[model samples]
Target chain A: MKPPVISAFEPPRRILMGPGPSDVYPQVLSAQAKPTVGHLDPLFIGMMDELKQLLQYAFQTRNEMTLAVSAPGSAGMETCFVNLLQPGDTVVVCRNGVFGERMRQNVERCGGQAVLVDNAWGEPVDPQKVEETLKTNPQARFLAFVHAETSTGALSDAATLCALARKYGCLSIVDAVTSLGGVELKVDEWGIDAIYSGSQKCLSCVPGLSPVSFSPAAVERIKQRTRPVQSWFLDQSLVMAYWGGGAKRSYHHTAPVNALYALHESLRVLAQEGLEQSWQRHQEMHQLLKQGLQALGLQFVVAEPYRLPQLNSIYIPSGVDDATVRQQLLRQYNLEIGAGLGDLAGKAWRIGLMGYGARRENIALCIKALEEVLA
Target chain B: MKPPVISAFEPPRRILMGPGPSDVYPQVLSAQAKPTVGHLDPLFIGMMDELKQLLQYAFQTRNEMTLAVSAPGSAGMETCFVNLLQPGDTVVVCRNGVFGERMRQNVERCGGQAVLVDNAWGEPVDPQKVEETLKTNPQARFLAFVHAETSTGALSDAATLCALARKYGCLSIVDAVTSLGGVELKVDEWGIDAIYSGSQKCLSCVPGLSPVSFSPAAVERIKQRTRPVQSWFLDQSLVMAYWGGGAKRSYHHTAPVNALYALHESLRVLAQEGLEQSWQRHQEMHQLLKQGLQALGLQFVVAEPYRLPQLNSIYIPSGVDDATVRQQLLRQYNLEIGAGLGDLAGKAWRIGLMGYGARRENIALCIKALEEVLA
Candidate 1:
């Protein structure tokens, strides 16, 4: 093969309305372009400490183990499972959508048994069913579930699930990938034992880092694990030495310095707009978008009470091709909306009003684009 | 705790002479600040294809399984191990410095037995010793070694070791993190089965992306794995579907869009400069820096032949505290040099001349700063 004669990649400025990788705040983008520094630099270490605190505020947790995973949300998800699950451990995994099934896969991959509590494609996870399963599986050590399923725009009750997990003597692990900054999530108050979310979602940061937190109980479980975490990279204990407090931080792997800068800026923006206010913005935007989509004669996949404000999944109208409309929106209007994943694929469309992307202007533009495309 | 009242982190420009995260090119930095786009966008996918080809050029490989890992170099290293090794597999590992030990750790984490060939730190891997180990361990399926030992500033005999591995009927996996662009690396020509590299090293890109390539033989081994790969995120097969060719791509995870743009820019710069020219330039800059360093009566860590042009380690001058001198350089001159790691910690200083940082100007400034600090 010959060498590629490629010029610099100049990506089109897309209005990202997809489930994730939502529109990055301009300051966050600029933060990434800031001059490079050593990962162990004093100022950088200071930035990391502040990043931990900011992540704590976002997760609403006082867990000292709160820090961003160097990889995406999947790796973050792996970090929770690998550290918490020893071989033969039983986990009550709630399978509501794509991410929950992913957790089941992770559980099995780690040699842990997953007793799945299944939910419909566009439905919230039932805590009553989860409690019954936990009661039956007396060996269950963890209750793993998605707080917000990006695939079907379903929002499960995290607080109720965590309470159920605690009642059954199981630690809770949450996949808050699309839920953290978009909805009402209180990790500490809700008694969440472990949690992971993506930077690309409601935080509107660059798409790499995964902001994860482990409670004292989760940390205790990790410390008492019989087998080492299968992944050295995703191993939380090793990562803690680097992200752990104090001026002297050991080198685990080089921290993605610039990406953290972007995260800090994004989280700073989140802090400036208080968490409650951000959630309200997403709710308001979802209401506006919902009204507009209804006017366009589209039907919602998820029930109104269980729907996520950030991610909205709507049924594909009869005779409208999935590829054609998404392609048109991409090429003609430079807009992106998620195609339904898993069972919802080809049948529904997922429109996001996530952080930085959640706004009146974006909603208006998306509605107009969809209306014209359908016409 | 009160929320962090931190402002946007405006990193002060420092002339980076640190091992890895060497000065990122200005264009690469600007590339990162470019507009956000969907990971599955046609434009972004096109860029991903170009990125694979560019990486192939960088590694001198035509391997179809070439793509960047979403995390840093450690994850890239883990990617190579977790995919290729199954439980009960024995790998003949060369232990010379920190990275080689890391290779052993990864193999053990994957439940594989590591048969180590010992070599002195700052010394290249002895091909004869590696060959002997390969012969003795009939169960050894893989030969793993670092091409360039970043911690010890030693450049090993990758071509010869790979040739030995091929002769011994073992697939070769190389740590090319520091060797990829600053030194000569021919993945295809050398018959290397697998290799993992860091974007931050010689490429001078933003950190967090690891460019990894696997030979057909290696991919074949992964395909025929007895058990599912422990870490789902690092599984090559799943990642391949997304980074693989054509219009119909599966979403494994969100690609770090802006980081890829920066890497593309960095690779474009490398391609424009040409690989051989980059090596020669690194050598030329190393010579310039060496003259000044030798004049100050500093002793090189690695002997003449094994010394890496991109990374230079020198013994700390007698009576000078390691932290004080490095801190003085940072605070006074706005220069950043690496502190020693592992066995070499507090005993030596590692100065880098990699990628954009490999220049006469940086060398001059580094030399002037060192002189003042020493005085």
Candidate 2:
């Protein structure tokens, strides 16, 4: 079998207003391409320490266990689950979107039972329903939900959810994949026990690394697990040995050196701009985008109060073919907006104003492009 | 909590001769820095198709299940195990070095029993011992071994081992993490049911992606499993839908778009160089390095017949501080060599000539640096 004669892939410079893989910060991309270094090099280890400090700030937690998982957000999600949920344990899982359903899958795969608190695709997880489920399932060891549901552009109330988990004596595991840099999340103040996020989302890095943080209580649970974590690669404890602040770090798996380099630069970019200010920018951009989308006659799937500012899920108009509009946007404008997933598939299109992608120019271009394409 | 005021990381260009993350090709690094794209973008999907085809060429197989795992080599190892090994299933695992032991760990974590076929750290798997073990453990459903022991510079007979597995009616799982592009490997011809390799190794790509291939038999085994794969993230069946050749790739997880770009470019580089030529280059470089090291009074860890050309593990001369020499080489010369792992720790040093790192200049620099540091 011969490899076909294929040319180098030169991706078009896209205006990415999609659910994620939002336009990367130029510095982050260039950082990854700078040079390759040995993962265990003293200088590289110094960089890893800085990376941990940055992750702690981004997650807003002083938890010593904060580090980026070497894989994507999905693996980060799995990391939290496999480390926390022992077999035969029950979890009160809130399912408002695709990520929530994924959480349920992680639970089942971990041999834990998922008692789902179902909500509409476009709505936030109802705290009352979650509390009721928690009351009913006293055996539940964990409460898991998505902070920002990228699938349907719904922003669930993570603070209230964490409080509910605390009240029920359950560890709070939050999926902050799309929420971290774009929303006001105080992991320490809110008492999030275990949290995971994506680099490509609000961090504006390439779509690979997942920044994750674990509170002391979450670490305690993991340490006390009788059975070993099923997936060795995603085992948080083993991973921590390499990413920890200590100088004498043991060899675990080979750290993804270049990806971590990119993450470091992206976090640096976020820090320079300030986290709250970044969140504010997303909100401001979202308001502008919302007005344009409204004037263009596209109805938003998520309600105003429950909406995620970074991810705006709008209805595909009555006659719009889902594929045609997305394809046209890609080919004609060199733009990319996400087609819907799960229940919202074919009915909604998600426009993102995430991290570095949250700019007035991007919003204006997106509106102009949509208006022209629709016309 | 605020992110520390850290300046941008500028990695020094070192000549990497480490056991695994050998010097990455500059084009591969620049390729990753290319503009970001949506995971489901038509152009990105086309690139993924090309990537799979190139992987097939590298592995010398026509397996439809050929694709890159989104994480590093460790996750790739887990993917092969969790998908194929069911609970209570038995596997005859040959442990020649660090990776083989990891295979045993994977088998155990998957709720399967691993029958050990232990070999010395610096030697290849003894086929006679493996056959005897298989004969004794008739219930052994799988045979797993490391094709190239990166830790000890031993290249096992994968073809002979795979043949033995076939004769015993057991599926063969090979860890080619260090062998892929630097040595001879034939997936279809050897009847290997499953294999995984790292990008950072001989492929000269950055250290995250792991290219994996599964024969029809392995795929069939996964489909027939009664127990769910322990990892939702590493589940090969679910992952296949995203990387499969079908035009409509369902969203399993957001593909690492930029990392895939790097992988495609690296694999393209391999294809253009021709697989056999790349292997021969590593062999030639190894002979040159051996001559230089022998002249420098260094001793090879593995015997000539069983040695791996890409990874050369040599004894650290007694009375020399292991850390001082390595540190000196790194600080003074900007050259990276590997510290021995596991059993060989403090006794051996692994110098790699892998993929893009297998050049005359690297060998020369490595020898000169070692001489200066040792003196």
Candidate 3:
């Protein structure tokens, strides 16, 4: 068979308002294009150090175990779960949306028993139910939950959940994939034992790397684990030897060099704006989108207080077809919005107001695009 | 503590002649700088189709399971192991160098017993030894080996190994991390059951993505597995839904969009040059490097036939400090070469002439740089 002749791939410029990969900053993209360097190059290692410090700022943590996982957010979630939970361990998993259910899968695949604390789709994980589950499963080693559920645009109270886990003498694993820069998450202050976030979502970076931080408590648990971490790629212990402090670093898996360059630029942008200010921008843009969406008679899936400002889930209008409207918007306006996933599929559309995508112009363009498509 | 203000990172221009991540083409780097798009965007998905076809050309395979994994090659290795091998299954793993040991780790982590068939570092796996091991462990479900061991620059007989696996009624999992684009590998003709390669090595793309292909037999094994794949992220079944055929793609994980762009361009460059030409160029450059290194009193670690032309592992001369020589090369000549890994560490240097890096000029420059540094 002859090889297919493929021309240079030139992707169309898009206005990404989807759940993730939300319009990476031009600087970040440019940074990504920087000349490739050896992963262990002195220059690259220096940049890695700065990248870690920048990640620390974005995660709002002073944890020494902070670094970007070489893979995506799903791998980051697995890293936390595989490192902390051993076989036959019991973990109280709060399932409110797609990511929470994914956490349960991680738990079960790691040979841990998942005692699910269920909540309505598009609702914050019920703190009361979590407490009860933890009380009943008193031997639970970990309490896992998604801080901001991207699928349903619901923001759970991570602070309260972490407190509950601490009170119950269990470590907490938090999925901050959608919450890192777009919401108020203080990994140190909120006492999150292990947290993972996507670089694409609210970090306005390319979609590959996952920034993760493990609190000292989480690190201690990993250290004490009797068995080796299941996934070698996601194993935090081995990875730390590469991303850990000090000038000399060990060879684990090859670090994603160019991607880290993009991440560093994104985190630097976040630091410049300040995490609190970035959060405010997301919230402000969400309000603008909310007013515009409300005018179109769209009802939000999650209640106002529990809603994630970065990911806004709204009901599909009565006569509008979900795919048709989204397709039309993409074709005509080059604007992309996420279709609902899992149980909310075809019933909702996710309009994102994430970092770099959270501009007034984007909000106006998305609303106008939807209006035109609907008409 | 306030976040440290970091300036834009400016990496020095260095001629990459390392074991992997050899000099990325200027066009590939430029492609990576293109505007970021949604991973599931129609345009991006269209690009993804072309990428799969391009990968098929590179791998010389028509297998429908060909796709670029979102993570690096290590994860790709894990993907093949976790998907095909169930608990208690025995795998005949050929341990010749660093990556072979990694394969054993993957097998053990997947709850499979790894029956080792050992060979010396810097030497290809002995096909007779592999056959003996397989005959002994008749229950072994798979035969795993690295086609090109990056640690010692030894090229194994993948065709012979695959044949041995087939003769024993076992699947073959081949690591082509350092072989793809640098050597002749006919995945279809050789009947490789599963294979994984890195973008960074001979593809001359960025380091993150892993291009993998599974034969129908391997896919069947994955489909027939009784237990769920241990990893949710690396599970090929879930990942296939996103990278598989058709216009519609399920959301598995956010792909490294920019990295894929780089891979597409690199593959396109490869196709234009043709695989045979790429391999010839590597061999030609290796010959040039060989003459130059011999003049400088350097000796190769591997014997003539088994040595990988792309990755030349040369013994460190007596009285020469390995790190000091490499550091001088980088500091003075702005050239990068790889230090030996695992058993070969401190005793050898891996000089690469991979995909875009395989040039007469690169060969000349690297040789000249090394000579000056040694002096």
Off by over 4 Å in 1: none
> Per-residue alpha-carbon lDDT of model 2 for A1-375, expressed as tens digits?
766799999999999999989999998999999888998989999999898888888988899999999999999999999999998999999998899999999999988999999999999999999999999999999999999999999999999999999999999999999999998999999999999999999889999888888999999999998999998998887888888837788888888899999999999998898898988998999999999999999999999999999999999999879998888889999999999999989999999999999999999989998998888
Instruction: Show the colliding residue pairs in model 1.
Output: none
Error of 3 at B240 (Å): 0.9
- The alpha-carbon lDDT assigned to residue A72 of candidate 2 equals 95
Q: Kindly state the fnat score of candidate 3.
A: 0.77
True contacts kept of each: 0.79, 0.81, 0.77
- Per-residue lDDT over A52-153 for candidate 1, one digit per residue giving the tens place of the 0 to 100 score: 889999998899999999989999999999999999999999998999999999999999999999999999999889988999999999999999999999
Candidate 2: global Cα-lDDT? Answer: 0.92
Clashing pairs in 3: none
User: Which ten-residue region of model 3 chain B has the weakest summed lDDT?
Assistant: B245-254
Write the residue-wise lDDT of candidate 3 on B1-375 in tens digits: 477799999998889998877788999999999988898888899999999999999999999999998899999899899999899999999999999999999999988899999999989999999998999898998999999999999999999999999999999999999999999999999999999999998889989989999999999999998899999998998998999946878988999899999999999999998999889988888899899999999999999999899999999999999999999999998899999899988999999999889888988888888877888
For candidate 3, lDDT tens digit of each residue in A1-375? 576788888888899999989999999999988898999999999999899889888878899999999899999998888889899999999998888899999999999999999998999999999999999988898999999999999999999999999999999999999998999989888899999999999999999989999999888888998888888888888898998846779899888889999999998999899888888988888999999999987899999989899999999978778898888888988899999999999999998888999999999998888777787
Q: In model 2, how large is the Cα lDDT of residue A46?
A: 94
Where does candidate 2 clash, by residue pair? none
Ranking by DockQ: 2, 3, 1
lDDT of 2 at B122: 98
**Whole-model lDDT, model 3:** 0.91
Candidate 2, CAPRI quality class derived from DockQ: high
